[model samples]
Target: MSTTTTAPATGTAGLPLADRTSGLVGSVIDSSTSLLAKQTHDIVRFAMGSPAADAIPTAALAEVARTALGVDRADAFDYAATEGDLPLREALVDMLADTTDATALDRVTITSGGMQGLDLACKLFVDPGDVVAVESPTYTNGSATALSYQADLLEIPVDEHGMDVEDLRGQAERTGKTPTVIYTVPTFQNPSGASLSLDRRHRLLALAREWGAVVIDDDPYGMLRFAGDPVPSLHELAAGDPLVFSVRTFSKIIAPGLRVGWVDTDPSLQPLLISAKQAMDTCTNLPAQRLVEGFLRGGYLAEHLARTRTAYRERKEAMQEALTEHFGGMARWTDPDGGFFLWITFDSPENNTEIDAAIDTEALFEVALAHGVAYIPGNAFSPSRRFPDALRVCFATTPPARIHEGVARLRRAVDELAGAAV
Candidate 1:
């Protein structure tokens, strides 16, 4: 794990400074490990993972094919308007008509999915050496995007209430790091399932306004609420401004394959994002977009959400009950009102760290695999010892029996680890 070293080029201090550029050629080259990490193949995963639900309203799929092959029309052909098809765009506009009293269509931009929305945001704001604020633990994808851009990330610690506001302010004013944006997943957050307080939401917006830093509202799980009251979106609370944005996707509530997601940003930023969209893929998959367009437009979408929500609510209950019965005080976690995954904090004799601090090491993951269970570790979220003893488990993809079995497997793994120490 030792990294190779390359010393900085040195030139006569009295000589012209710009002449030293030639000596720096090999000094700043990208590392080989950076490339290999990107190429590393991951094992099959079921999260926080699940295949598309059975009730996808298949008639819409057939209709999409008909439209694509020109069986009924020729609209799917040619380079898509580079701004996405009008039908899908309008459908998105209609879908989010409920997003607020202040946000407008001119404020929305289409991208492949929430991931793309975030990538575009990072590309727009983060520059090498720029500071980016994130929840102490955050989505792995988002963190990677910032890091690849070489942005210096400052993590704002979190408690059960969500990201620490005071920590964020201190970082913003820190001498060395200059922050460009604040990224967050406020409701049913990934891996942590921590929801922000409404008061914190208002305070967060005000702080962003004061600091002139834009906030990226990554809320794919907001609508997945299973048992609690709703929190107003950052976009809704912040009013209209170039400084705040929200990224919403259909993946969770509908199907991940659709890749239809939009950003609620200032009107002035729309053209820039649309430009970024054109370069990414011109537009998202036409067939997928059309199928979702049909699905949402035909009016069966509401029923689809209700069906999934009810079933997922049951799964949530099972996860909670299983944790309480087994881990109990040994691990603490939020009973998410609604969302696909639950976050667990392991109370181990040793602190769970980014590497060996976690119980689910290479050995533990293998043990869980053999025991018919699997999960993503807490460190993977931010590569920090934020809570070395924490772990994330997903319940939405599996049925009741599988959920129970997975929890049992996790219990056995924990016991085995403790026994080895004894």
Candidate 2:
């Protein structure tokens, strides 16, 4: 698993890049923001899993920014403690006191975002060639982080109940290599919107225990649940086990631009997290921390979540209804209680292989974009290009009317692509 880099034969600059640079695979998800920004079309963007435009508490945030980041509070602009700003940490701890992911101040380290939390986890645990089990069609950024650390990724299957824990065991048995880390987005998973069942959750914990593996539980959408009973977070279920590292973010629940999130791990790991963070970005952005602190201190999150959950539930239902009307038997999608996405797989009664060939999501992306609609190709979610016939649609962004329009545009694009193929 050794990676070596050779300098370009003809390049005159003669700058030598580290071998690790080869492993720095970029995120298609993040790249879409730039790709979409450059386009001039009246596109219904279903690519980025951002909260709806109307869902963002802009006016409230502006007010918080004005007050919290004012010159009177000039200290907000200063460098923060590597652990995080104290006010934000205190607010977060108070905010999560009654929740399943509640933790003590010592265990919580505010991060730039959930992605940094993932990066930190990899930095702390992964070694070159270490086995890391990632859900098939997992979050690209999460998997990419592991790859950047030179971890040998094992893509595990995911069904309606989330990652197949039983299959994970079988795969480990077959490969004869125990995974050093099991990275999962267990609840309302990013692209799939599937929650791991309580039974499988227990099994995964047991397997991690046997393998002595760390579980990187990345749950950004847990609090936006609009339906179904709440499942305990991996951190809650682990009961302070050092093996469970939980990453939470305000990106999905509040605002992504704020880029504020936190990690909950064993108290012993906090010192290491601080040291690691110091060498990385020095500190999480201070002004953003103050803004988040202001938002939390003003008690805005509860009402915000209530409004967001209701809106997103309606949006999810709208997306499903549109898919039913347009796709019907042509495709199937996951029904998530809450989250920004629903994973769709193209299918047909004619033949599986033929239909899949007829509809390549990677190819369809351009067609859909040209037709004033956009979605993330299924292949982008998989490192092995496993779901070329699948795609992820974010249901939390557009309204019901726009959702229908976008689906109609997508259907037209699909038809055009299929016709052109013939």
Candidate 3:
């Protein structure tokens, strides 16, 4: 049975909330936006995972907007097809022809964004109390979406190669239950910035097939590769397998505020996807769809991606250098070839018994903010609050100089915390 909520009476102080809403956990990642907005300090923001302020092609978008939403075309403002705008869909199919995630016309369905894609996947597959496998240090919002559907989460451990598939199989077997949905960011994962290796990707698919589960391939950052060789996407390897449901977005590669994304599924499932979408928001915003269509058709994305890749590469290197200079032996971090994040954790001494090296990152958040730096605590990424000593820092949004400043501030924050502890 679907859990539903009733709205409170207009004059009432409190309303009856829904049972499903109890699991509606908010995103710490998004909360930082409002938190930072009120600050009067000159903070070096490393909190939000976004493109650098100068990275957005404002001039190009503004130029396109004139024609994409021209006064001459009244239909530009009308309701689009639930599947997607026809022109945008066609352009997308052509645009992805040489990419790792190429798909046919029938398999494409436009969505509001990648978040809605995850929600749709859960709504279509997840049942109340069904096991849903997720990475331990997964994107909290994705796991929260599953939780909202009342699904029981099985937190699989993640490493440099992404989710440990062998461990997942063993854990699932021991539980005597199979997961209905397996969610993965796959390439350049959010928070951790780890890509699933090819071997593990194949293994994950095998397990999902054996268990009759759907693979929610939520890859928003695959195309932003500034380093390393390309790993084939789960959608490509699946090769028309209906079990793989791929969610992609222009939010990362283009502008996030646009909120335009698409889901690539088996052709047979397109109708269901359309129906599911129709019952949600009627249709995605038409003007945004048209703008993206203009961008793609004008041959601007390739140049835009190339330019940003170079900038992001420089930014990532800056963050790594800053970490080495400031953090040194006190902490360790992941060196991602692409994507926007670097996961940092404190190094604990082997002989130390009285004090664990793990600083409570959650407790340190306020201190870091006061010191004019910010990062999402590792516990925010985990549903079970694991890794209290770690946090995620975004390098894509800040410049090289600001990155150094932020890390220095973070180091000072740690010193302040230590001083207070003493």
Candidate 4:
């Protein structure tokens, strides 16, 4: 008897996908990197929240790698502890000693990057149908991780002082549902670049305690502050509360390619995090951890941060100036003291009929790309698609001159779109 074989189904057509897979909403911010890489033109990148190429301490990292991952150090290539490499953990403890994010060894767990730390938080705290409150126009990647775990999201509004805690309270009351987890960037927030005010921070903690919610303090850019008074981190303000789960990364302050970050959780959760991490990645990349360890131990971070802070401050100013020069009549933007981005919202200038009455930034993105510039459409930042008239621009990656050029290109794109509409 000859048996005929059937070909297995490919893609999602006939395959059985998990119910949770539907929740795996990927990052548009990250996807932009690939999209820009495919282009051949000279485009000034203002999308990804990445450090400038010159801002990275390449020479210092190279020198550290010589000793940290020398040819003879074969063990550096092996698996690390599920919790983290001891040397690196110890270095982190020492590195954060004087900062607002200071923590002890038992509370720390190494992660693949800030993204993994976010994934781990959702994995541990969120369950199917659980409510997860996130900042409106939040870091979509973080919210995406929560979604991937089958959590229902509640978007809270964010203003210059960061997540409006009062709005959160009112929303919770109106919905009659308390969140299971509250996610915040807290300091130098991505896209908006706003920091949470001290009073709001305390109020948030109180509300989390009252609702029995876990606060995921995902602050990757806290250390990159270049202006204004340093506000206490949610982790610092928590004062050893187990409800606070802090996720930090070296990506912004250091090289993003290294893919190294850590979590400071309650010591009680360390074992659970280790078990969960082992089931996921086995361990964080050992080589990357070693490299970060060396970077911290060498006392290179302080100087590196200082230099990048100054550069970012200048770049932020340049972008603001360019925006004033070009879009001043029709757009308004946030003034963030630190971080990679500034959120821009378009509107009609009074007594000005030259520009379109309304600008859809999502429609304007492709036109901007064609004009040799790129930025994240505002809708991408909000899960609810609330900001069609806005967009996000990263002012950290380009130099002053290039920022001016990119802004000019963006203005041209807007004009081109307006002309087409007319």
Best by the lDDT measure: 2
Q: Give the candidates in order of lDDT, highest first.
A: 2, 4, 3, 1
lDDT of 4 at 99: 92
Q: Across residues 17-121, which tens digit of lDDT does each residue of candidate 1 receive?
A: 453233222201123224223433432222444423563546656665564546555565556665566777777777667755235557766678888888889
Indicate the residue-level lDDT of 411 in model 2: 91
Error of 3 at 237 (Å): 0.4
Model 4, span 49-105: residue lDDT tens: 889999989999999999989999999999888998999999999999989998999
Candidate 3 residue lDDT tens string, 1-422: 00122223433457666677666776778888888899999888888988888989888898899998888978999998999999999999999999999888999999998888988899899889999999979998898899889889999988999999998899999987689899998988888899999999999999999989999999999999999999999999999889999999998888999989999998888788888888999899999999999999999999999999999999999999999998886788998889899999876645333333447788788898999998888888888888787889999999899999999999898878866775
Q: Report model 1's TM-score to 2 decimal places.
A: 0.83
TM-score of each: 0.83, 0.96, 0.95, 0.96
Per-residue C-alpha lDDT of model 2 across residues 1-422, encoded as one tens digit per residue: 00111223432367566666666777888888888999998999899999998999888888998899887987888999999999899999999999998889889999999999999999999998999999998999998899899899999999999999999999999999799999999999988999999899999999999999999999999998999999999999999999999999999988899889999999999999999999999999999999899999988989999999999999999999999999886888999988889999998536543334357888888889999998998877777878877899999999999999999999999888887887
Model 4: which ten-residue window has the lowest total lDDT? 1-10
lDDT of 3: 0.88
User: What clash count goes with each model?
Assistant: 7, 0, 0, 0
Ordered list by TM-score, greatest first = 4, 2, 3, 1
Q: Which residue pairs does candidate 1 place in steric collision?
A: 226-337, 226-338, 227-337, 352-357, 352-388, 352-389, 353-357
lDDT score, candidate 2, position 279: 94
